[model samples]
Structures are given as C-alpha cells and as structure tokens.
Target: MQILLLGGHGKVALHLTPLLLKRGWNVTSVIRNPDHESEILALGKGLKGNLNVLLSSLADVKSAADAQKIIDTVSPDYVVWSAGAGGKGGPSATIAIDQEAAKHFMTASFASPGVSKFLMVSYLGSRKKQPSWMSDSEWAGVVKVNTEILPTYAKAKQEADEYLTALAEVRKRDPNASRFQAINLRPGTLTDEPATRMVDLGITPKGRGSVTREDVAIVADLLLARSDTEGWIDLVNGEEGVEGAVERVAREKVDAVVGEDVEGMVKRFFPEAGLKF
Candidate 1:
C-alpha cells in the first residue's frame, strides 16, 4: 500500500512512519522543513517499505487544486493528515493549517482517483455537542478547552471534523464521486509517554483523560489497515489492547455526529462552501 502522510516531523507521525514501513507499505511523508527529511527517511532505513520526503509547506496549499496537485503527484492509496499549527502562529494560523488546509486535502482526496482513505488526527473535544455517555464534569472540561483555553484550535478541529463527516455523506449519496473514505481518530490529551499498545476506542467519550502519542500512532496504524472502519473514533489510554479495541470498534458502527442531521450539519458548519449533494 502507498500512504501519503502529511506533517512528517510530528511526534505521532514519527512513531507512525516506522509502523507503516515495517508493514512494507511505501510512505511519502510531507514536511515543510528540508532538514527533517533525513530524520524521517532514517525511520524507514532498514524497513521493507520505501520512504520519500516531499518538502512543502501546508500553509502554501491555498486551495483544493493546490492540494490535488500534491495528491496527484503522490497518488497514494491512503492519506493521513497529522499536520497542525500546534497553536504556534495564532488564530489565523490555526484556521489556515488546522481548518482550511485539512478541508482542502479532504476535498482533494475526494477528487483523487488513487486515494481510497483519508485519516485525520483530531482531538477528543472536536465537537459542539456533548455525548450522552460523558459525565457533566467531563463535558465541562471539554467545553472549557473549546471555549477558552484553545478556542481557535478547538473550533478549527470541530469545523474540520464536521466538514469531513459531511463529505463522507456526500460520497455515500453520490455514485459518481470517488470512493475514498474519511476517518477521524479523535484522541484525548496527548502525552510524550511510551506506547502502551492499550486504548479505549469507540464512539462514546472516554471521559477526560490523556493518551500517549505513541499509543495514538499505534491506533492510527491499525485503523489505516482496517478499511471497514470509518467515522470518528474517540480514544484514550486504557486497559484493552490496541488491536482488540480497534477490532471491536470496527465491528461496531460509530455515529460520530449525533443530535444533528447531515444536511443540517453541512449547512450550519459550511454555509458558504456551497457543497453539493
């Protein structure tokens, strides 16, 4: 399999590249900094899969056409969006990279014939409504982050997730559209801890918790292979093995967006985009 991974220099991407390479799946990692090329290439040094680094800035990707060019060049079977502004360049930067860039890629993926799956690394609180399974305290914490702490980042993620979900619906309704599926892996607060290979994955919230970047990468790797799974998966550090958790979630259907219809969601989240059914 050929995978196009955006944000090659990210911690999660760093962990994920090795896993994909070990599986003998060729990966084309996109990074803005040329200096990181060797570092990423080293991860696949002795692995079966070939590694190629594409030096490009996601901020420079202005539209779907710009993103489609990259997708066409790579022609990957799977595309993973791990890139983010990391809350570094302010609100505009967050919107540009986290929201706009992500949507561009999603739109481009839909148009790309070679792309079959587009996986997004999103946060656990990337939704406007709280799930019924979550407790009051848990929902409050999520709201705090979305409304105050990382407001811009949270809003960007929320909109991006909504847009991707809407696009998935569009794909289902339109027979002529490309068959590429969109998957959102929403993990809890991230940490630098080692991989536990254990996680809680499903549609319901796992309360307020944190997960290791390594564990998230492991889950991402597994999810990429499980083509049967789609929609948003909420994850956190837990007792269940990663493989088992992923398998269980794959067997069960996850309605990522609840309390809102697809048409309403698209209209509310993307009023100006003019997304056609």
Candidate 2:
C-alpha cells in the first residue's frame, strides 16, 4: 500500500512510519522542514519499504491550487493527518494547522485519483458538544492541558472531525461511487512513555484516561490495513494487550463478508466504538 503522512516529524508519525515500512508499504511523508528528513530516513534505514519526502507546509495549504499540487505530487492510497501546531502556536495557529489544514487535505484527497482513505488523528474530547456551563468566551480562552489550551485544542479538533464525518456520511450513502472513505481516530491524553502494545478501543474509555503515543500509532497501523473500516473510534490504555486488540479488530468481518447494513458494518468493524452518522 502507498501511504502519505502529514506531520512527518511528529512523535506518533515517527513511530508509525517504521511500522508501515516494516510491512513493506511505500510511504511518503509531507514535512515542512528539510532538517527532519534524516530522522525519517533513519527510521527506515534497514526496513523493506521506500520513503519519499514531499516538502510542504500544511498551514500554507489553503486553496484549490494548493490542494491540487498535493494531489499531483503524492498519488497516495491513504492519507494520514498527524500534523498539528503542538499548542505552542496560539489559537490562530491552531485553527490554521488543525482545522484549515485538515479541511484542505480532505479536499486534496477528493481531487487525487489514487487516494482511497483519510485517517484523522484526533483527541478524546473532540466530539463533545460545547457544554452549557462554559460560556463562549470562557471556552475560547486558553485553558491548559499541560501547557496547551484544552478548550481551544478540543474545539479545533471538533470542527475538523465534524467536517470529515459529514463527508463520510455522503460516502456511505453511495459507497461504490464515493471518491474516498474516512476514519477519525480520537485517542485520550497522550504521554511520551514507550509503547505499551495494549489499548482500549471505544467511544470513550471506562473513564477519562491517558495513552502512550506509541500505542496510538499501533492502532493507526491496524486501522490503515483494514479498508472496510470507517468513521470515528477512541483509543486509550485498557486491559487488552495491543496484539490481542489488533487480532480481534482484524478478525471482525466487514459488510462485504456478512451482507449487512451500515450500522452492522460499523458495529462489526468497531464493536467497542460509538457510532456516528
């Protein structure tokens, strides 16, 4: 499979690239800086796959022309949105990288004939409705999650996730004719701890929790390989080991195999996840 990744230097993307490479998949990473090229290369040093770099800034992808340029440059089977402003950049920066960039990528995917799937690396609170207790001004303010603004981050993600889910609805209604499919992955608070190789996949975990960045990458890897998989799913540290979760996910037969409706399709593919339109 040919995969294109945004945010090439990100912690999760760095881990994901090597895993995809080990599976012998052709990978193209769109990176803003040339300096990070070596790190990506180093990951694939002894791996079996080919790594290609496309130098482009996600923030600069604002127009159809920009979208077309990306489509033509990297004819990808799957596009992974892993890029973000890392919360250091203020709200404008977050809107640019997280919302606008993600929208442009979806547009670019539609324009690209080779692209089939779009995977979003979202967050735990992304789908939450704006709470009645929090006023607009208060919600928009920088409420920190660690050093990042929790509300701003969640709002940005919510907008992006909503847009993709809308597109997914249109695709599902006309699966054979739809241009591409999509899946939004919302993982809980992230930590830099080493790969746990275990995760809880659902709408929300048993409770609010955190997960290792590496474990999220592993889930992404499995989801990418399952073409029939679509829509949103949340990830967190859980009782099931990563290997077992992956096996269970892989074993679930999709609609093509079972002659089922869309709801059944989603339930079988992501039994633990909450279903959206």
Candidate 3:
C-alpha cells in the first residue's frame, strides 16, 4: 500500500512512519524543510517500505486544485493529515495550515481516483460545544484554553473536523463520488511518554486525559488497517488493550455527536447503564 503522510516532521508522524514501513507500505512524506528528509528516510532504513520525501509546504497549498495536483502526483492509496502550524506563525498561520490546507486536501481527496482512506490526527476536544458529561470545572479549563490560550488552534481544528464530517455525509449520499473512508483520530492531551498499547477508544467522551504519542501512533496504524472503521474516535490512555479497543469500536457502530447530549449517545454504547443524569 502507498500512503501520503502530511506533516512528515511531526512527533506523531515520525513515530508512525516506522510502523507503516515495517508493514512494507510505501510512504511519501511531505515536509516543508528539506533538512528533515534524511531524518524521515532514516526511519525506513532497515524496513521494507519505500520512503519518498516531497519537498512541499502545506501553507503553499491554497486551493483544492493545488492540493489535487499534489495528490495526482503521489497517487497514494491513503492520505494522513498530521500537519499543523504549531502556533509558530500566529493565528492566521494556524488557519492557513490547519483549517484551510486540511480542507483543501480533503476536498481534493474526494476527487482523487487513487485515494480511498484519509486519516486526520486531531484533538479530542476539537468541538464547538462541550460534552454533557464533562464537569463544570473541566469544561471551564477547556474553555480557558480554547478561548485564551490556543483559541485559534482550537478553532482551526474544530472547523477542519466539521468540514471533513460534512464531506463524509455528502460522499455517503452521492453514489458517483469516489469510494472513500475518513477517520478522525482525536487523541487527548498528547505526552511524550512510552507506548503502553492500551487506550480508551469510542464515540463517547472519556473525560480529560493524556495519551502517549507512541500509543496514538499505534492506534493510527491499527485504524488504517481496519477498513470498516470510519468516523470520529475519542482516544485516551486507559486499561483496554489498543488492539481490542479498536476491534470493539469498529464492530459496534457509534454515531459522532457535536452537541452536549449525553443520554442518547451513552445509551447507544452502554444500553444497560441505568445511571441517572
């Protein structure tokens, strides 16, 4: 399999590269800096996958047409949007790379003939409204970060996710559209801890928590292999094994929610839970 991985220099993407390579899948990693080419190539040194570095910046991709041109050249079977502005270029930069570039690539993917699967590494709290089950204190903290700390970054991710969800819906109704599947792997606060290979993956919120970058990479690899898994997934460090958690979530269909509705969403996953809201 061939995969086009955006944000090749990212922490998560770097960790994910080896897993894909070990599977003998060819990966074309797109990076803005040419210096990082050797670093990315080094990951596939002993692996079977072919590594190709595309010297391009996501900021330059302004339109769907521009993104489509890159897609046409790569002709990848899967696309991973792991790139972000990282707050270096300010709010406008965040919107340009995170929101606009992401949407453009996704839109381009819908038209690309070879692209079938698109994976987005997003934040677990990337939503317009807080979940109903979240405590007031927790929600307040999240609001502070979203409004004061990283407001632009949060908004960019939220908008990008919404755009992807809308595109998935449109594709579902249009039979003539290219056959595609999109997975929004929303991981909680990311940490540089070691890989535990254990996580809580589901549609419902798993409260505020931190997940290891390695574990997130593992989950991304697993999700890519499972063709039946699509839609948004909430991920965090938990007791369940990554493989089992992914299998269970993939077997059971859970609808993604944007509002603060808890009862309906919870009951769908845990029908016997008689807890009162």
Candidate 4:
C-alpha cells in the first residue's frame, strides 16, 4: 500500500513514516521546503523502499496548489494530514493553516484515484459544543484540552472536524461517489516510548495519558488497518495501574463531574429542540 503523509516533518509523522516503511508500504512525504525532499528520501533508503518527498507547504493557503500536485503524483491508498506548525498563535493563523489547509488536503484525497483512507490527528474536545461530547462548564475544560496551540488551533480543529463529517455523510448517500473512510485518531498527549501492545481504545485516558511517538505509530497502524466507514475513534493511552485504561477512567471522571448522557445532559444543557440545526 502507498501512504502519502502531509507534514511528514511533524513529530508523530516522523515515527509513523518509518513504521509504514517497515510494513512494506511506499511513502511520499509532502513538505513546503524542497530541502525536506532529500531528507525523507534518505530516511526511506535507510528503511529500504521507494520513499519520495514532494515540495509543498500548508502555511499559505494559496500554496494549496502544492498539495494538489503532490496528491496527483502519489495517488496513495491513505492520506494522513499531520500538517500544522506547533506554537502559540491567534485565531487567524490557526484557521489559515489548521482549518483551510486541512480542507485542501481532504479535497485532494477525494480527487485521488483509488484513495479511500483519510486519517487526521484530532483531539477529544473538538465537539464540546455538540450534545455528543459534553455540556455546561465542561465545555471550558474541553476547550483547554483541544486547544493545544490555544484558541486558534482549537477553532481550526473544530471547523475541520465538522466539515469532514459533513463530507463523509454526503459520500455515504452517494454510492457512486468513492467509498471513503475517514477517522480522527485522538491520543491524549504525545510521548516517545516504543509501542509494546495494541492501543487501549475502550477507555478514555486516565488523567491525561501521554503516549510516545512510537505509541502513536502503533495507533496509526491500527487506524490504517481498520476499514471503519465514518466514525471517531478515541485511543486514549495510559492505564489505571494494571487493568483499566483511559476509557474506563473517563466514565468515572465524566460521571463525577456532570454524569453521563443518560442524565439528559444533552437536552437539558445544549438543547436541540427549538433551533433547526
């Protein structure tokens, strides 16, 4: 299989690319600097396979053409968008690179022949305003959780998530359209430890689980391997001492804070009754 990675220079992508190479997958990394072209090529030769890099940058939305060009050449089986610069930025910079650039990548994936998998690195708090995630002041906490790059990054991720969800639904209705499978892989906090087991996705992280980049590589493999139609998969890392994982821990934390969805938290707080959304 061929995988085209955007922001291959990213921390997580660095680990993921090598993992894919080991699995005999061809990789074409997209980056803004032509300088990175040689870097990924060298990394590929080190791993042993046809690893290529295309020059592109997500910083400027106008350069979206660069992304399209790379997509045209690679025609990969999966397109992973890890494209973003980390650091403090206001909402404007956030939306430019995070939201709009993401849109460009997804659009290109749709255009790619035979490409069906579109995976993105997203956070859990992305949908706090929606009934599906939470209600009340819980939203403020969610905001902090998702806003790794602060408000700007959070806004961008939120917009991108909603947009992709809508796009997936449209395709689901149109069978003639490509049968695309998109997933948001949510890891608590990125770490650097090597993966020793399959991800514990059944539970939320136990107190902000931090996963190593190696662990991220494992989760990415699981994500790319699964062919789930359209849904969100939260792979919160960390264990409660021996047995329980984050998901199990989440039930306790959420229940302690405001209780479960069974308590009518959805209707009581952010009611969808009056407004036609």
Quick one: best TM-score, which candidate? 1
lDDT of 2 by residue, 92-128 (tens): 8998889888877876775566888999998765644
Better of 1 and 2 by TM-score: 1
Predictions ranked by lDDT, top down?
1, 3, 2, 4
lDDT of 4 at 161: 66
Count steric clashes of candidate 4: 11
Ranking of models by TM-score: 1, 3, 2, 4
Which regions in candidate 2 have their CA more than 4 angstroms from the true location? 130-149, 175-179, 247-277
Question: Candidate 1 residues 166-243, lDDT tens each?
Answer: 888767766666566688999998999898888777765555688999999999999898778888888899889989
For every model shown, what is its TM-score relative to the native structure?
0.94, 0.80, 0.90, 0.75
Which model is ahead, 3 or 4, in terms of lDDT?
3
Q: Which of candidates 3 and 4 is the stronger one according to TM-score?
A: 3
Compared with the true structure, all predictions reach lDDT values of 0.87, 0.73, 0.85, 0.63
* Candidate 2 TM-score versus the reference: 0.80
Query: What is every candidate's alpha-carbon RMSD to the true fold?
Result: 2.1, 7.9, 7.5, 7.1
Which residue segments of model 1 deviate by more than 4 Å?
176-178, 268-277
| Cα-lDDT of candidate 1 | 0.87
Error of 4 at 206 (Å): 6.1
